[model samples]
Each structure stands twice: as C-alpha cells, then as structure tokens.
Target: MEIIVVIGGPLEEGAIRRWLHQKLQQKDNQKFQFIGVDGGCLKLMSEELPIDLAIGDFDSISSGDKEILKNYAAKMIEFPSEKDFTDFEEALMWVAKSYPQQKIHVLGAFGGRVDHAISCLWTMFRPELQALIPYLSLEDEWNHISFLTPGEYVIHKLEHTKYLSFISTGSVKQLTLKQVKYPLNHQDYDFPIALISNEFIDEQMEISFESGGIIVGQTRDSWR
Candidate 1:
C-alpha cells in the first residue's frame, strides 16, 4: 500500500492529478491510503480526492471544513494545537508506527515557508522514522525529494527534472557522484553542503557515500 500525505502548502488540481498519474505508472495495481493534514484536507476534498485518514489539530480550518472532513474521512486523528511537534511530524509518526511497511509519499510539503520546509525535510532524520528513510519521499510538480543512507544507489532521473542535487544534513564522508554532468570523486565534507545544479548525463545516475544522511533532490526550473 502507498500512503499519500497531503499537507498545507501550495497545490493545484492539475498538478496533483499529474503527479498521482506518474505514481500510478510506476506501481501498477497498488492501493492508496490518502491522508489529509489539517487545512490540507480542504484541498483534497475540493479536488475530489479520497481521504482514508485525516490527521492534524484542526486549528487551521473553519468548523465547516472540519465537519466536511469528519463526514468524508474514513478515520481521523486529532492533536492539540499547542503541541511540541508540527502537524506534519505528528502525521509522520502516526504513519510510521501504524504502517511501517508501506511507502509514504508526501505532497503539498514544498513551496511553503522556509522554516516549515526545513522542518519537514529534517523529519526523516528523527530516530523513530529512521527505518522509513528509504521508503519516504516528498514531491510536487517541481521537485522530488528522497533520503539516502550509507550505501551505493543507482537512481533514475524523474520526468521533467533537469537538475539533481545531494545535500548533507550532517557529516558526509567519502561521497561520490557518477554518470552525472559534474562528477565527484569520494569527497568528504564535515559540515552540511549542497552539491546543486548537477545534470544527469543519461537516464540514470550513480551515487554512494560512506557515512551520514544525504537528501537527494531532483528538480526542474518550472512546471512545463
């Protein structure tokens, strides 16, 4: 099963359809568990998308909207508005605990406030979410994000993505980039750095690192 988590970020009906279509193409005959976070449930309903589970504090939306969610959502989990973790983090924790074997694809998490975006990115590094690193991804029309541990990986370029970047959240050692426009040779970085704007020379590219976590992003300049 694939869990689709939608949050409160900029989203378009056409873009959401296009993205979901791509996901269907990749995995044929798979079931989807739609999760709506707070105000994001409003967008999902407006788009006529399914909401298997609704999660959040319900503080961002009006009572009418919450009533709509209560009627349509198969299940709902509510949290306190004054909490330590963000709604996104709470949703992730719930998903990780409940559906550990399922792949999680998050939407509407990009193009928001800089701090919110960063918080969502770092959620993967949480100790409880460590096991989900390989299975979790954040994507939108313009960008696709994934996490990588210490291992060699051959990742293919996503459709409409022109640039590939690898960013380190902590110490990254012996990192190498292969079959890319600007290749790296086992370079080491003690601090976080972004190897940005690198293009793919072919359909796929190779990357490997010995230590630390790397956030891989494939992005385009705009929605074409």
Candidate 2:
C-alpha cells in the first residue's frame, strides 16, 4: 500500500508556509491513501484532497470541522486527548498492523519542536517500524528522510532533493557511498556521526552496507 501520514505537530517559525506549499505541489494526485492526525485532517481538506482515514484526538479542530471530517473521511479512528502514545505514533502503529508492507510518505512531521521532530525521526528506529524502513520516506519542503537496512541500494535524483546524508543508527560496517561528491570506500562506523551533508554528482547514487544499517536524509539546496 502507498500511504501518506500527515501529522499536525507544531512547525518552526518560518516553515509552515513552505510546508503548505509543498502539500499544494500535489494537485490531482490520486496515487496514495492519506492518514491525517489531528490538525492534519484540515490540511488535507484544504488541499481539496480526499482523505482515506482520519486519526487523532482532534482537540485542535472545531466541532464543525470535525463533523465535516467525519462525513468525508472513509474511516475514523478517534482517541482521547490523553493517551500513552502520540497521535502520530498511534496512527503509525495502526498502519503497521493493518498494512505491514506499506510505503509511507510522512509530511507535516518536522519543522516543529526539536524533540517532536526527533520523535518522528526515531519512528524508523522502532522495533515495529524498522522492517518498514526501506519502504518509508519522511518528507517535507526541504528533505526526504528514509531509513534503510543493510543492502545495496540505488537512489535516483529527485527534483528537490540534492544534498545527501547517511547516519549510522547502530554500528554500520563497511558502508560505502558511490559516485557522490565524497565517495566512501568500505568505511566502518561504530558510533553515529553527523555525516551532515554531501551532494550528488550524477543522476544516481549508490549506497551499500555489509552489516548493520543507516538512516538517510536527502535534502534540498536551500542555502542557494
């Protein structure tokens, strides 16, 4: 299944507009199922997009908007404002159980409180979610974040994603980056490093790891 999870966490001071623009980028899009958490429901609605499922405490939405969502959403999963897991986590867990092989595109998850963004980043590290990494991509206006298991992978150039970063979640052995600005030849990383930024020199990039795994962040050239 191709799924898109929209989380309504707080965004950074200047990011909300760009984030909204990113959502607007998808017009007449009919390829994926949308899952809105909290205020995210309104986001999808504003875009004139159909919502497949809406899940959240929904304290952020007005009663009238909630009624519209209930009528428009194909399925509703409501929970109390006070819960053990975050609304996004709850939605993710449900997705994991219902569609284990899903390729998830997450938006409206970053540009928030630092900790909140970290929580979204760590979702890929979860035991239940790790297996879904290769199929998962956390996206925003400036980044395409993904987690990958040990294997050879080829990544193609995407319009907005130019800079690349590979971080070791655990201990990655013999990790290699091919045909990039800074190519790595069988490098080993026991502890995680910033690996902050690199660029693509060609249309395609080749990444591989002999053991362990990596969390890859493909970002835009926002500095330009």
Top-TM-score candidate index? 1
C-alpha lDDT values of all predictions: 0.90, 0.80
lDDT of candidate 2? 0.80
* Displacement of the residue 56 alpha carbon in candidate 1, Å: 0.9
lDDT measured at residue 2 in model 1 versus the true structure, 0 to 100: 87
Candidate 2 regions exceeding 4 Å error are 10-30, 62-64
How many clashing pairs per prediction, in order? 0, 1
lDDT of 2 by residue, 126-209 (tens): 776666777778887788888888899998876677788987867888888898999999998888765768888999899988
| lDDT comparing candidate 1 with the true structure | 0.90
**Runs in model 1 with CA error above 4 Å?**
none
Q: What is the C-alpha RMSD of each candidate to the true structure, in Å?
A: 1.5, 3.5
Q: What tens-digit string does per-residue lDDT give for candidate 1 at 23-112?
A: 788779989889999988988898788999899999989998898789999999999999988898889889988899788889998877
